[model samples]
Target: MFHIETEIRLVGPSMKTIKVSSRIECAMICSNDNCCSSSYDTILEHCSFFRDCCPSKEFSKESQTLTKISGFNPPPKDCSELPAESCSGVYVIQPENRPSMTVFCEMSIDNGGWTVRNDYLHFILRQRSYQVRFDLEDFTGNTSYAVYSTMYVGDESDNYKLKLTGYNETAGNGMSNFGGSSLSGMMFSTRNRDNDIDERSCAISRKGAWWYQSCAAANINGVYSQKYSNSAVYWRSWREKNGQKKTMMMTKPKP
Candidate 1:
C-alpha cells in the first residue's frame, strides 16, 4: 500500500511542486495522485513529487541534513474513468442512538440521502458520523478535501475533518490492509470494526465525539482524542463532540 522512505530523492518524470502543510500531507497528495509515484521533502516543507519513478534510498544527501520521505503507489490515470454505480448496501438509520449508516463504493447515491452537484457530494449527520464507501477516483483523487461548509467548530481546539481511508490498525501509520485488500486510503469502513457493514472502507467525520477511542478512559471534556503524528490516520478524522455537523467537498481534477 505505502512505503516510508527517508532521506532520498526520487528522480524521474516530474510534476510541478506546490505548497503543502506537512510532509505526511505531501506524501498523501502524491499517494492519491495517479500521476505521482513518490514524494520527497525536508523540515522546511520543500517537497518534490515524481510520476514515473517509485521511492529510492540511494541518493546524494548531506550527512548533517538527514531527512526522511514517505512514498505510496498512486493508481493509474484511468482508475476513475468509470461511471457511478448504484448505492447498494444495508443502510440502518435509527433516531434513537447516534445516526449512522453504511455505503458502498459501486453504489449510486441519487436516492440514498446523498446529493451530488457538479463534482462535490453533500450530506448531513444530524447527531453523529457516517461510513462513506466511494472510490477515491470518484470523490476527488485525494484523501483530503476542502471544507465546503461546516455546522460549527464548537471547540476551537477540536479538529473538523474527514478521512478517505481503510481500517484502523494500531501500527505504523495507524493504517493497514483491510479484508486482505491493498487499497489503503479510499475504502469505506465503519467506526464499529465488528459491524455487519464492510470493514474494508473509508470514513468521513465532519464533527465526531471520539467514537472509536483508543483511550482507556472516556474524555469527559470535549478534546481531540489520542494521536500520534500529523499524518497518522488515527487522529486524522478525530473531532469534538459538542456541536457536530456533516458537510464535505470533493474537487475534480482538471482535464
Candidate 2:
C-alpha cells in the first residue's frame, strides 16, 4: 500500500525517471525498488524514484508524493509480528481496515517487539493484549520504571476506556497510587475532546492528554518542567514534587 499525498512531491536526488501511463504504474515500479518514496507528475505522466525523500512544502498542481508502505506483506498489526531479531527503528504497520502508519519499535527492551506511540495509544492497545512499560526519570536524575503484564484500552466509541492489571512489584509499582482507582475505567481526555470525569478539561489544565478521573493521580504526558507543578510529568506513587524529567511508554504483546 502507498500513502498518496497530493499537491506535494518528494524532494531529493531522483534515482530514475520514467514515463508511466498512470499513478498506479508509478507506485508499482517504486514498490519493486528499495526506495520508500516516489513522485508522480500528473500532467506529464512522469514518475521519479528516490532513495530517500519526504514530502516537501513545494506544492504543485501536477505533483503527488507516494510513500511505499514497508513491512510484512499484509502489514503487521503491530510490532510483535516482526522478527525477534529485528532492530529498533521505524517501520510501517497497518491494522485491519486501518490506514498504514509508521511506528518506532524498541527491539532491545525485554526481548524486543515494543511498539511506541503516544498519540495513538488506544488505537494500538485495542487490537490485542499487551504488556505496558513505563520508564521514568525524576528531576533529581533518579530513574525508575513500572511494568504491567496486562493492558489494553477500549475503542473511541467507549471513550477510549483504559484497563490495566498485573503490576510487577519487582519493577517498582509506580502506578500503585491510582492504577486501580477510577483511572482504570476513566475515559481518555484531551484539550479539545473532553471525556474525563473532571468538570474542567484535565488535558488543558494538566497541559497534556491522558485518561483522567477528576484530573489524574499520575500523568506521564504532562508538561516537562524542572519544578513542581500540577501540569508537570509525575507519578504520585513515585515522585510528586519534582515532576519527572523524562518519561517513556512502550508496549508489546503479552507473553
Candidate 3:
C-alpha cells in the first residue's frame, strides 16, 4: 500500500525522524505522525520522514532500506463514510499483458449508472480487505469476460488512508490471460495512461508491470474510494460504459 521500499531513501524533501530498533518500528514512528506520508529506515536504527507522503522518486536498492505506510489500521466500517449509492471517483482495472490498456470500462457516478451494473460490479468492504467482483464488459454492455473475478484491493494514495491499497486479487480465477494477460499478481495504479500523472484514481495490475499505450483513464478521491468502493468503482465504471469516455477524467471546469 504505502509504497514500501527496501534499501532506499527519500532524497529531496524530509519531515522528521525517530530512532527505532527495527524497520517495523520505523513505520510505527510514521504511523504516529500525521504529517508523515512516506518513511524510510536506515541501518543505523534511524527512521527518515518525508513530507511528500507519496515518494515519486526511484528507490535505490544499494542502501539498507525498508519503508511502508505509518498509519492504516482502520475498521471495516470506517469506509462507511463514503456514499453508498455512487463513488466520488473512477478507477480502471488493467491487465498484465496489454500493460497500457484497460481491461474494463472505467467505473464512475452518473445518471444512475451504478444501479444498472450492480450485479456485475459488486463491492464489499471486509474487515481486512475491500473486495470487488469485477465482471468485465464493454460500453455496449457486452461481456468481455463471462464470469467475474473476486479481486482484493491494494495500491492506495497518500491523500487517502485505507489499508490494503494494492488492488490485487487474492482469490478467484487466480489470474487469466483471456483479455491479454493473467490477472493474478497484478498491482494497482492511478497514474493517467496519457499524462502519466496520478489523477488520484485507483488502478490494479501487477507491481512493476509497464503499460505500452496510454489508452484511457479516470480520477478518484483516494480517501472517499477507500471508504466507499461501491460508489467509486461502480458509478465510475458505469459512466465509462455510457460513453463518457476519455484518456482520463476531464478536469472539472472552474466555476
Candidate 4:
C-alpha cells in the first residue's frame, strides 16, 4: 500500500535496486464500524530499481553511463520543522556515482527538437530509510541526471533527541555524535522541484508502521507509517529517434 522504508542499492552506474520493507493489506473494521487501527500482522517484500523512480532517464540497449547514480541523497520531509541550516544541504555522494535525480533533457544539439524529458517521481519514508522512484518517460536525445535532493527523519542510535541538525541524514555521512541507538531514521526526496504539481505534493509520506513507543511517548506519534513492498515498481517508458519509435524500455528507470 505504502512504503515504510526503502533501501537503495546501486549495483552499476546504470543499474541499481531498491529493497523496500513494508506491510501489505490494511486491516479492516469490526462490527462497531470503526476499524481497528492496528497494523497488518505480516510484512511484504519488493525489489525494483531506484532509477525506476524516473522514466525519462532510462536509455535503451544504447545505454551508457551518461550520468551515474549518487549513493543516495536522502531528504527531510519538507513539512518537517528541520531548518535548511540544520539539514544536510550538501549531498556527500560518492563522486564516481553521485545521486543525480534532477536532470534536464539534453537533446542532441543537431538532432534536438521537441523533447520533454521528465521522470515523474515519488518518495517513500520509513523508520530507517527513504526510498525514491520514477514512473514516466519519453525522450529523443540521451538523458542526464542530477542529485535532486535529500532529507532526514530520526535515528535513535545517537541520543533520544531527534536533533541531528542538517545533512546528517545522508547515511554513512549521517551522524557520528550519536553512535548506535535504534531510532527510526529516514530521509525522503524527489527530482521534481515543482511542488505546485499534485504528485510532487507528496515528497514525504508513511506506509503502515507504527511507533515502537506509544503515540504520547517521546518520538512516538500515533500516525500511520507507509506500507512498502517489492511490487512498488510501477513505471513506464518510451524512446523516439529520428521521429520514429526507436525503442521502448519495458523496464523501470535505472539509477
- Which number leads on TM-score? 2
When 1 and 3 are scored with TM-score, the better candidate is 1
Give the range where candidate 2 is weakest over 10 consecutive residues by summed lDDT: 1-10
**Local accuracy of candidate 1 as per-residue lDDT tens digits, 142-243:** 232222222211211222223333333221121222223322222222333311123321222212232222221112112232333221222122221221
- After TM-score superposition, the amount by which residue 188's alpha carbon in candidate 1 deviates from its true location, in angstroms, is 17
Off by over 4 Å in 1: 1-6, 31-34, 55-57, 60-208, 212-255
TM for every model, in the order presented, reads: 0.26, 0.66, 0.24, 0.16
State which candidate has the highest lDDT: 2
Ranking of candidates on TM-score, top first: 2, 1, 3, 4
**RMSD score of candidate 3 (Å):** 19.9
Error of 1 at 22 (Å): 3.2
Name the regions of candidate 4 deviating beyond 4 angstroms.
1-19, 22-45, 50-53, 57-255
Residues 79-182, candidate 3, lDDT per residue (tens digit)?
A: 22223432212222222222221111111322211111111211222222222333333234343211231233333332211221223332223123223334
- Give a tens-digit lDDT track for model 2, residues 1-255: 112333443455778889986544576577778777666675577888777646345544456555454558878888788877554445677766678777766565677777776556677776777889887776565877788888878887987888888777433555533444546776788888998766788899989988887777677888878778888888776776467866778898788
Ranking by lDDT: 2, 3, 1, 4
Ten consecutive residues with minimal summed lDDT in candidate 4? 213-222
Candidate 2 runs further than 4 Å off: 1-70, 170-182
Q: Report the lDDT tens digits of candidate 4 across residue range 40-115.
A: 1112333222222222332222211111111333532221212222211111111122333322221122122111
Q: Which of 2 and 4 is the better model by lDDT?
A: 2
Give the per-residue Cα lDDT of candidate 3 at 228: 27
